[model samples]
Target: GASSSVFSASSLASSLLSPFSSAVGLASSGFVSAAFSFTGDSTSFFTSSATTSACSVLGPLQHADYFGLGKLLSVRELFEARVHLGHKEGLLNDLMRPYLFGSRLGYHVIDLDKTLQHLFCALNFIAHVAYRNGIILFVTRHQQTAHMVEETARESHEFAHTRWWRPGLFTNSTAQFGTVTRLPDTVILLSTLDSVFEEHLAVKECNKLLIPTVAIMDTNCDPRLITYPIPGNDDTPAAIQLYCHLFKTAILRGKERRKKDEEAAARQQQEAAGTASDASKQPTSA
Candidate 1:
């Protein structure tokens, strides 16, 4: 209920990203546990059972949210980011009717419970892709948040396409850029709609190319067009920042996991090589 557009107030603005202030200032799993517990243990979406530690059920130690990305942001924090606030009820799209938490002062309030499930799934997908070194492209249209989006991509060592979407970027890559020019394995659309009446061309282009998409869409936007639609207030800078923070964290976690895996493989190979050399030296005497 705090985001009154921009959150210009000094106190609110200062605490806007207290939990996600930096890469090291990451949010703890405590908040996540508390939030999920409050919501009647709705964590089944993230894992088989994250909270239950009974002897019968060991629970999945390595689950999708193993990175704790799901725990990084609580449902209450979603309200703080103004993600629950949607466009006016008059602009509601019938396709998005299911995501409504009901209208508040004529504007739609998105169901944060649903948002949590979809957001976790989307983040998990992103992290999995990143772990394989998959190319990810951030797409946005509004100049207001373009710089932030681009910066987020750069920090995560990914690509960003904030300018006009050339018609043949995906369908006709050879003609649009070059024959060797590669397309991203995944696309994250910060905003799916180009304007009030039209959806972004990249949405269709990615769908045609069979490239997966993770999109942040408002209540006025259609979720069917997106491979994974995260319902929230896509137009707000605060919300955009929150989205960027969560995604960037996921990417970094994925990369970190990849590094660890590579190191482990290398160590195993070295140990095997050493073992073979020792055996060769001892076999001559035998």
Candidate 2:
């Protein structure tokens, strides 16, 4: 009776701790091995199995998150998004001087005009790539805004590494992970420079691979590092969301445009074939 009670308590504890673990049968053995062994084996099994499931499910979405490219982002939206806010003047980059309006208190304020200009260039570049069916990888190392980045990436139907920028993701793709057949054509960095960590290895790898990068660079970040550096507040949620929405819009626009072009090409081919057939059927004017 005592053994049954002990086993029941252990089983209840295990169930409470691991909801994923299967129910264990009552062990008649009063020995500690009978009780502890099943618990240990079951815990390891469920833990490993759950991890595998998560990895398999989140490997990559089946399709890009294309909710219709929507419309082009506007300056008024940028103004409202508060994307102009930046770090202190001492943190400012000289090359980014063109993108600054002036300083308020101690912080450097970003110029909405230049931001819009750069944004358009960046979005247009992204749209062009998407139109050609190129892959984009959105990367962020900041935990605070990582969820937003992942959500944006999923909605945009692109790949993302919000958790951590695994070093050599591009350079060691096939070698690091043998089954990996492809790497992203472009990388969009949510945070160009992480204050907490060392330089993002993904940035260097992208450069080495010659894969173009679009980065939301804070005033403290070096503009020369990325291919398309958009000087803005990479720390704020609102600013990141604005950029994400615009990029998603651009990607959708490009995909839509590509689809239209494809459809048009198909129609033209059909029409040309019909015209040739009609000519063949026409009586010769002798």
Candidate 3:
């Protein structure tokens, strides 16, 4: 039976604010500002903030930027590649759920943590591949987990000295289905099965007809429901932390490519403008 506890914004807020909410709030807000200001010129504000607070205090961060040199790939392209690999390896069903239903849901509900960890690892792996291929990645989750991701990103930036994290959008019970319509071509990372299951189901159904999805599968979730199901734990803080780190690394790698592309484009535009100015200044003796 589905738990009777209703998912609420207040509950999420309380969960996020429980201990280091102040720091998370600062980092999340800072990340948003930085993502938008990710032109080629400005200093990475989020990285600066993380250095001052989270990373310096947490320890060394794993730098994901080392894997950013490759041809660009899209989320859909990565999905297709994974599907091809799974099919060639005869692991299609093992890697993907055709349809999520009754007994499958039961299996997921039984061992949530291990299931979530598996799911996390798989998603992380996909994100890693996507990053290496130069594809952009974004993760979206319910508010509590989004807060956790932001906190982890801050820690990673501070420790790793890399500017590659963004704040995940927040969703709640009342508006659980909100962001799906706005999903970019990037991957979406869902967290906290109990809170976002309904929305997750909604997304699964919707994507079944149209969009391709990659998801983390906890034991509590029906594997059949997710396109890419990783069986593992969903309840442990350690599991969540591990998954978020993988995601942060992937996104950071993508960001590095994006930065380089932007710089190249800017440089070309400047050269063209300079050429045009030079032509205009030359005397036309006809």
Best by lDDT: 1
TM-score against truth, every candidate: 0.78, 0.72, 0.37
Using TM-score as the measure, the top candidate is: 1
Error of 2 at 21 (Å): 56
Model 3 CA deviation exceeding 4 Å by range: 1-192, 195-202, 205-212, 218-221, 283-286
Query: What TM-score quantifies how close candidate 3 is to the native fold?
Result: 0.37
lDDT of 2: 0.66
Q: What lDDT score is found at residue 157 in candidate 1?
A: 98
Residues 1-286, candidate 3, lDDT per residue (tens digit)? 3222232433322322221223223221211111111122111112234333543343211211123211231223222222111111222233224222213322422233223323333433344334344332334445445667556546434211112122222223225554443433334444313353443433443344433345555433455544444443344555555556655665565456546656877999999999999999999999
Give residue 87's lDDT in candidate 3 (0 to 100): 15
What tens digits encode model 1's per-residue C-alpha lDDT throughout 111-138?
Answer: 9977876787678778877887999999
Which pairs clash in the backbone of model 1?
none
RMSD of 3: 19.8
Candidate 2 structure quality by residue, lDDT tens digits, 61-100? 1111122221354556776788889888887678788788
lDDT of 2 at 80: 76
Candidate 1: Cα lDDT at 44: 29
Model 3 lDDT, full chain set:
0.37
